[model samples]
Target: MFARSLPIISLLSIISLRSVSAVDYSETYVGCVSGTGTSGALASPNVNTISDCNYACADAGYTYAYFQYQSAGSYCSCKNVGPSASEITPAVSGNTNCGGAAAGVNALATDYYYNNCYNSPTAEDTTSQSTFDACFERCTTYTNAFVSPAGNVYSCVCSNTASTGTAQNCGVSGTYFAYAHTATSSPSIVERRKRRLSERLKREEQTRLNRFCPAGLEACVIPGLDDSFECIDTSSELESCGGCLYGSTGNSNASTGIDCSTLPGASFGGTTCSAGRCEISACKEGYNLVEGRCDWHV
Candidate 1:
């Protein structure tokens, strides 16, 4: 039985290898990042969607990006450093529906949570923030931000500057929450996603082409054929090549592929076709082709 299962096991192994990618981004979602140290913040109101925000952050040279909803639509904040363990609340996916005042935390605009300070002395501030989203946005402005609730007032404060340092137990007397921003994205994952997206687009294009062209012939256009498509064997056709383009002139007849041998300067020129394209390696020694015209080599 073990011998019979060898091939099955090997096939499964190959399938698993093919399926592996960077990581499951959905599983990695960490609520809403609120507090961060006092640095590495690039904020923009235009960015929407988590992927777009992550890409923008990566482009801005940040390793982590955070998305949050505010009064002004949605905003994305980029930062290099990640939140600390102490700052992160455990498994808080959305704003906790404060079952009355006992719960203390208010309902965010939508629902947001992150690795942040929860009624800790680490984030003590004088500026008053009315809502959690406001406090979150305020924290993003600085490298580190924390929210402390004194009675009904929520004060947003900065805990540290730079990527280094630790949170202090300062806001013990008041209900407070602190959060730090951490880099949740990496260049490798971005590249993988891009590659997958590109492959999907290519597959979609090919599927569309399949609907139009017969077997063996791919949907393509000949050189000089603008806005026109033809079914041609790119593997053997001398014109369409891997794509289409008669060369710099773009003056090839759409119905028939270019005949390099028929050209004046290319006469007696040893032209060969490879991979569905034609190429003239050399013009008969004394011949030259220049400026859309071919002539004898000077």
Candidate 2:
């Protein structure tokens, strides 16, 4: 009885080992699912749903899988089961071959276009519809015909034979179309002109001020004169006025025989000399004459 039991146990152990060895660790196409895009190879062992294809492929030991449709439509799912952790790279296809090994190729192409090409306004408007139709038509034309510099990949071109004539008709309208173009152009030109005018006015004002003040010289308007006088010019009688004044100094300097250069200790007034000339004979308190010149006492 012991010898018979030993044979049975050994046979059962052999059968279990065979079953474990039979499991294929290779990548495979699981089933149909949804995805979008047009370039790059897809991984295997995938089933289609509006789910995360990246996670699915990674879970199945695949580097990546391609999705074919933006909506809920037929798609290909793949996974990589290559030994030694090698990635399964597939050939780029114009259409998704959903049933077999080509299942996720179309989805990959759609993703490539939308992410890379459709980001720009010119590319997006031109290729969005074309890309959609090309995916539908890829079941037949698997040729590597068109390549986008922006997308950095090859893709299928959809037939635009119908809409070409209509686009030409729209370009030929009337005066309204001309007016629209003019309207856009005029504002930019006007803004440039206004900026130039403002700059010119500022430059002219600076030039006039520089002529009279001539850098590094303090300038003062002469009392009772329309012109300004520079302190650098000793010949100008206005500079002899005790201190600088900003505007027309109304006859105050001429009426008082006070030589501005001789004012003992003068302070700036709002617009005229007030209490620094000793020739006035009488002055307000906190003032006194020193050597025939008015000076502040305190």
Candidate 3:
């Protein structure tokens, strides 16, 4: 009798372990992300359903759980930063298998999940931004910017003049890690990240037809504008990788791509846009790729 019971118990244990990612979960739904993930991934779990994977992610003490459609619902991992996920990472929006906001977007083994950085203080020109590198990329046309990151939300404000805001607590009433621009030419190491988001919203419509794009191109909405968009070639765009989008937007914009150029501080030719991400052979200078966005040094 003891022998028979021991085998039964062992079999049950094996079955339980195998079901960790076998179905969908009822946890609050987050948005879908595309492109590859930044490092810090644990060995992924194997399951067969979105519900089951969501449960597994909760068990792992993460706020979000993501899986790939090609995995047939088995390959998945846990994350704490989600819902307000990585808009900085491009996407393949309209994927029904991902099981999140709107019709649904999809994820790849390389897809990323990130925390939301919010803008509490609110600037005159703000956009959905996550990392300092992303903010820097957005402000490529401006001389200054303000980045505010709050829980589950992130944003960057672009400006043409250097700001006195500095790295202060202005976004969320002291609940922010806000960075402000200090100079027109360069910034102090600390200010580099704060004012990094100075100019990236400037548009060049000389070669664009807003209502529609020529073949081999897609229309992407421009941030800080009203019903405005740009035509781009996802295959080679630095700002719209993979597909095309400003952030983790819905299919309404027609695309959900990441800004592959957000790998700020990258040495000339250090980072390249491949499909939908900023791929690099190695990190040069004071740069680190965290959660799919470049860290613009301290």
Candidate 4:
């Protein structure tokens, strides 16, 4: 009876040893990536059912994964998959069971090269406000076609072939985002022409104000006043200028007076010209000379 029992125990021991060896040994080969489909060692790449793929990587000690969809079927591998594993570096010619063994490898290599080579905990290229804004705009338009994954933020992965954009993980946290519209031109010439016209109108209005109003009174020109001028008194002019208008009024005690010295390129204590076209020399302090008239000091 002990002999029979000894055989049984020996068989059990062999089975146990095999299991331990399987667990201890590491297998390297070219296959598809698995879980998260993002970048970094944290992502899982075991090719299995989404759920199984999720756990297979953990069981296989891999954190990242991808699934290579091909004419035959899907295949999976861990982070260890490489050209040497299948005797086919990305440079090698001919086809192999590995998805990256064909001419298509160029595109796949681009994706893998960026995702695996530049793995970072922070968003890639998101160092400035402008970059963030541009990336955000692209993400908004492209939606999920590209992903910038949160933790593996160095590169973006394209979801489908229809997507014509790249993923940019902008930010310190490796946040994944998509950026489309590369190599695309800007608005058409007609659109630019319209924008230029609008800008020109603004400049014209500003030029008119500079020609007529006191130096600082440019801000006082109300919007849409194409050909209108208001005869503002000294106090009103001073308020518009944010201070007392520098210039002597013909009638110093007069409540209403125009100080031309406030105009540009005028000298202090210059001529004073009122709204009625009356002019006076030797104006009060803060006034300036402008075209033989005392302009308000700005």
RMSD of 4: 27.0
RMSD each, Å = 15.1, 31.0, 23.3, 27.0
Residues 1-298 of candidate 1: C-alpha lDDT, one tens digit per residue: 0000011111111012222222222112323324322244667666545455554443333444565544445556665444432333322333431111111111111112333334444443447866544565555434455565544555667655432244333334343454554223223433453454445445545566656777877665543457556776655655455443332122233333454445565646455556655666555556875654557865
For model 2, the stretches where C-alpha displacement exceeds 4 angstroms are 1-46, 68-75, 79-298
Sorted on lDDT, highest at the top, how do the candidates line up? 1, 3, 4, 2
Residue range 1-298, candidate 2, lDDT tens digits: 0000011111111012211111111111211222332234343323344234433332222322454442334343432221110111222332123433323321211111211111111211123213322322331222111222112222323332111111111111110000001223334433443344344445444445546655544344454456544443222343333333342222223332334433444433311333332233433456675654466887
What lDDT would candidate 3 get against the real structure? 0.42
lDDT of 4 by residue, 178-252 (tens): 323322221232234334434444554446555665653432322244444443343334223332232222212
The reply for model 3, stretches above 4 Å from the true place, is 1-26, 35-38, 71-73, 83-298
Q: Give candidate 1's TM-score.
A: 0.32
Q: Against the correct fold, how does model 4 do in TM-score?
A: 0.21
Tens digits of per-residue lDDT for model 3, 168-283: 22222333322333234333432332222111111212223433677877766677776666778877777677776663222343446766554565565566677666575545
- Window of ten residues with lowest summed lDDT in model 2: 171-180
Regarding lDDT, does 1 or 4 come out ahead?
A: 1
**Residue-pair clashes per candidate, as listed?**
30, 31, 35, 47
- Best candidate (score: TM-score): 1
- Best-to-worst ranking by TM-score: 1, 3, 4, 2
Score every model by TM-score: 0.32, 0.16, 0.25, 0.21
Q: Model 4: which ten-residue window has the lowest total lDDT?
A: 1-10
Over 4 Å off in model 4, which ranges?
1-132, 136-179, 182-184, 187-270, 273-298
